[model samples]
Target chain A: MTTPVLEARQLIKRFGGLVATDNLSMTVNPGELHAVIGPNGAGKTTLIGQLTGAIRPDGGDIFLHGRRITHMPTFRRSRLGLARSFQITSVFSEMTVLENVALAVQAHSGHSFRFWKPALRDPALREAAEQALDFIGLAPRRDEQVGNLSHGEQRQLEMAMALATKPRILLLDEPMAGMSQEETARMVAILGPLKKSVPILLIEHDMDAVFALADRISVLVYGRIIASGSPDAIRINPEVKAAYLGDDDA
Target chain B: MSMNRATAANMVLIALLLALPPLAGLMDGEFYIILVSRALILAIAAVSLNFILGFGGMVSFGQAAFIGIGAYVVGAGTMHAFEDGIEWLGNGYTQLALTVLFSAVAATVIGAISLRTKGVYFIMITLAFGQMLYFVAVGLEIYGGDDGLSLYQRSEMPGLPDLSDDRVLYYFSLGVLLLFLYLSHRVLHSRFGKVLTGCRLNEQRMAALGFPTYRYRLVAFVIAGVMTGIAGFLLANQTDFISPAMMHWTRSGDLIIMIVLGGIGTVFGPVYGALAFLLLEEFLSGIPVTIAGYRIGEYWQLIFGPVLILIILYARGGIYGFLQPRSNGK
Candidate 1:
């Protein structure tokens, strides 16, 4: 079997008395969108944090393309094509949308130690940023200051920034958190074509979007994966239905 | 359009600064030339602080210590020249080179430790480092300890214009200031500046996007330190003396004030800020007014405090903000 693009092996993270991420393992393939859905405090964000190198696991390891990277710094992990969006929209607000994405492109283009040449004039970085923005449908608003963008647009800008890094896999944390119905639909459309090139690990509460996009689904409860299978299989699985869908139905 | 206003204002400022020495000669006297030169030197220091403080969001409160280090290098180097016949130490060119080298080295050592912390802890740690240097300066007995040391002769470069002439010194300092200002402007717009500003705005995001912000911030801190060190070198030349008092924590606080007053983040804000601050200090100190039957000449600080408070309260964008068009003022 081909190696999974990302794999977590027995990850454990404890927060004093409560284990935030219990002994858990998961894998994302190169061309699959794996969705992880759970109720609040289910440790989905913690898992994402661990995957992105923001949070270190107390035990076990994470591998990217079959290489162990459990102890790499966040920036190094990013350079290795592991990119994640913040749960909250986090773009350089004082900068223009193009500038924000350009900075992301600049990160992977080369070392940022070049101090004399103006970055806005860099054709390669600008082209890459523009492509990302165009892909995310934010090309029209490219010149606007990110601070002036709407919340949903800001989230799109965040995706543009992540994409500009040329990630091998995208870890999206609540991309539709504050998005309106139309915005969510737009985001779904924007993300539809991306999975063919770069796999995504989506942690979302919007089950409809998750169900529509995910090739496979994992149900996490109290920091542990209770079930992992095709969305249809998990939808009908007794354990998942009883533990999670039962609550959603009511 | 607003950018044009800012550019035009900057040009006018540069023009005024260029015209100052002759204007001083025509108006006030040699003292005015010295005072304006002092302002230019302090402006250089303030501009350096703005790089980290405004752009990088690193509230370093120890910048004066680097300046102090530069001044002391000159002081100690001069003393060593006279005592041990260290020929290179007496040369102005060599002294400047030594000051830049030593200051960069000091910044590297100091920044490596201080950049480890963030926010208030970062501010406090930098302050602590500044105070540490202050004490070290005070303890140097050979450099006159508390009494400070005076330079009998300013360092001189052969075949170049003498630095001893007040006009020559003023123009030389102005030239250095412009060069640094240009260099800083380039840096602020470069890829390095974007990353630094990105780190300032969202460090976590910058890291997530593959920027090693700590190293960028450390380099920026050192750059600011070296630039301020240049200011310190000029200060030693301007004053012809060196003392531990130059590195006092309050002096660092004053540098912060200059940055804030001018407009913390803007490129030339510190220049405007330094000019306003020094001019106000001169103007206030010269006036003797009776308020409630008490002389307020030496008590100018009492009035200055309230004015600063008023500016902070109403004009959040600062004096430079007030000058720019409202849309892009910030």
Candidate 2:
């Protein structure tokens, strides 16, 4: 099998007395969309935090493209093509939409120590930023401040920023948390074509979007992965249903 | 449209500043020129503080420490020269360059430690460092301690106009202020500025996006320190004296007030702030104050305090913000 784009082995994280992420192990193969589904406070976000280097694991290891990156800083991980979107929409609100994406492009383009030339006037960076905005259908509002964008639009901009970095893998934490049904559909459409190019590790509570897009799904409960397999197999897995789905058709 | 208005206002301010020395000569004589030059020097210091405080959201209360560092470099350099009976230490230009270098190095060390904390802790720690430097200045018996060191002679700069003349010194200070302003403008619009602003807005987000924000912030902090230190070099030349008073905590507080009064983040806001603050102090001090017919002598702060409070309460964007068209978006 092809090497997984991202791999976590026995990841552990604790917050005081509670183990937030307990011995969690997961992988996303190249070109695959792997969804991690769990109830609220089930350590889904914590797991993503560890994967993206925001939260250091108490024990275990993480690898990116078969290279160890367990202790890498968040920025280094991003430079290595491990991009992530926050569960909370985190865009530079004071900056324009294009500026927000341009910053992401600038992050990976080269050292940002260039202090003389105006960043907005840089042709290459501008072109890439414009492309990312165009891809996300936010081109019309490119000059508008990100703070003024709707919650859904801000989510799209967050994704645009992640994509602007040209990551080999994407880690999205609840990208559809506050979106309306139509917005969620639009987001799903946006992610559907993206999976062919970059592997995704999506932590989501929305089962419909997860089942539709996830090539494989991992059911996490109480910080442990109770089951991991194709969506159909997880749908029929009795253990997963009892532990998480609760007899409901997920 | 707002950007154009802001640019026009800035241009007008610059034109006035450039025209000041010649205009002051025609009107009042040397005193006015010296007063305005002092204002300009302090403006540079305020602008430098704005980089870390306004733009980077690092409310460094110890900025006066950098200014003091610059002044002390000049003081120490001159003291060594006087003791050795040398006319000047390779000219004033070399002294100024040394001051800048020392200030940058000092800022790097202070910033590395201060940037580790956030919000109020950062402010307090920086204030502590500033006070520490102030005490050190006071303890330096070789440099006159609290009595302060008096420069027997201003450092000489060959090939350029003599700085001994008040008019020449005023113009030189104005030139340096404008140059630093231009450089700062370029930096604010650059990629480095973007990252600095990004870190200010959301450091975690910037870090997640592949930016080593700590290093970026430290670089910015050092740049600000060096710029302010240059202001200090000018301050020493303007007053011909250096003392621990230069780095006093109240002096740093005054710098913070200058930035806030002008409009914290705007490029030329601090300049306007320094001008307003110094002019207000000058105007207020000249007038006698009375409370309910009881005379209060030279307590200008009583009136200044109320007026500043009113300005802060009503004008959230500061005096610069008050001057701009209200519809202009941030």
The DockQ-based CAPRI class assigned to model 1 is high
Show where candidate 1 strays beyond 4 Å. A247-250, B1-3, B291-294, B326-330
Residue A84 miss distance in model 1 (angstroms): 0.8
Fnat values, one per model, are 0.92, 0.90
* Model 1 lDDT per residue over B1-330, tens place: 345766788899999889988888888688988998999999999999999998899999999998998899888888888988887788887888887888899889888998888899999999999999999999999999988999867777788788888788889889988898888889989999999899899999999999999899999998999899989988988899999999999999999999889888888888989989999999887787877987787888987898889987887767887777545424
Q: What is candidate 2's local distance difference test score?
A: 0.90
> Candidate 1, clashing residue pairs?
none
Docking quality band of candidate 2, CAPRI definitions: high
Taken over the whole model, the C-alpha lDDT of each candidate is: 0.90, 0.90
Model 1, residue A132: distance off in Å is: 1.0
Error of 1 at A13 (Å): 0.6
* TM-scores of the candidates in the order shown: 0.97, 0.96
